[model samples]
Target: MGRNRISGVIPSSLGNLQMLNDIDLSRNALVGSIPTSFANFGYLFSMDLSNNELNGSIPKEILNLPSLSTFFILYNNFLSRPLPQEVRFLEWVGTIDLSGNHLSGNISMSIGMCKSLEKLLKANNMFSGPIPDTLVEVKGLETLDLSSNELSDSIPPEIRNLNAL
Candidate 1:
């Protein structure tokens, strides 16, 4: 459910659906961290927990979902902390949006490992440090918005080769 009056913490019991392919709980008043039990969704392809009151770092287990290929959005939440390095495991994901949060730290260099990534929106957060040069490895990246953060240094010259950008 999304864009509703729903409030309170997301139920951890929702993770028991191993056959689930998509989940949309966005635009709600939900609070609390994402349940680690969500890692059990082996078939999940897309998940939207955006526009909520959720806090805490994104669960590395969710990042490890092999079937999370279409999109994974946690936008406009209260989530914080460095994005987990395990995000490198999303090799087939097409889009990832973690914007409008309290997350901090350098964007993980390992993000280059997302071989199929297209749109990566990470603006409006506290991320600091130079933009990782490894981002050039994501050849399919088209819409990369790392604006509104504390990122410094020049954009890597190699990024010019990404024709899709």
Candidate 2:
């Protein structure tokens, strides 16, 4: 449903597409939580769930996907706590966009482990705490954004290492 004006929950039944490797539901008017059924998309390698009215927690199971990449969960009304501990492995991912939500709590140090991260856009949220020194561990991090939040701390020395950004 790319660029469709469809609003409301993505049918939980979409999870039944077990062989689907790519799903693009971006730029839609969808709302509510991403169904837990979505974790059933085991073969999904690329998913674009960005630019919607979706809310609720980021499912932990989605992070465990072995071949998944290109996650886009941006520009929505997501009201939730910090992402799960397991999502840190999303470092194996590319182009994750989780901007414009109401998520709070410390930005996980585990995110530093996502060495494959690029196009990382997380701004306009309630995320607080210091920039973790561990963030330097994400080697290919090209776009590190932590803007417009309540984040308070001295900039970590490790950030200086990202001169490439």
Q: Against the true structure, whose TM-score is highest?
A: 1
Instruction: Put down candidate 1 lDDT per residue, 1-165, tens digits, no spaces.
Output: 999989999889999999999999999999999999999999999999999999999999888898999999999999999999999999999999999999999999999999999999999999999889898999999999998999888888888988899
Q: Give per-model CA RMSD.
A: 0.7, 1.5
Where does candidate 2 stray beyond 4 Å? none
* Model 1 residue 102 lDDT score: 93
Per residue, candidate 2 scores C-alpha lDDT tens digits across 56-159 of: 88878777776777664555566578877886757668877778888888888888778777767778888899878887877777887889888888998877
Q: Best by lDDT, which number?
A: 1
Worst 10 residues of 1 by lDDT: 152-161
Q: How accurate is candidate 1 locally (lDDT)?
A: 0.94
In candidate 1, position 70 carries an lDDT of 96
In order of listing, the candidates' clash counts read 0, 1
Show the colliding residue pairs in model 2. 91-114
Error of 1 at 110 (Å): 0.6
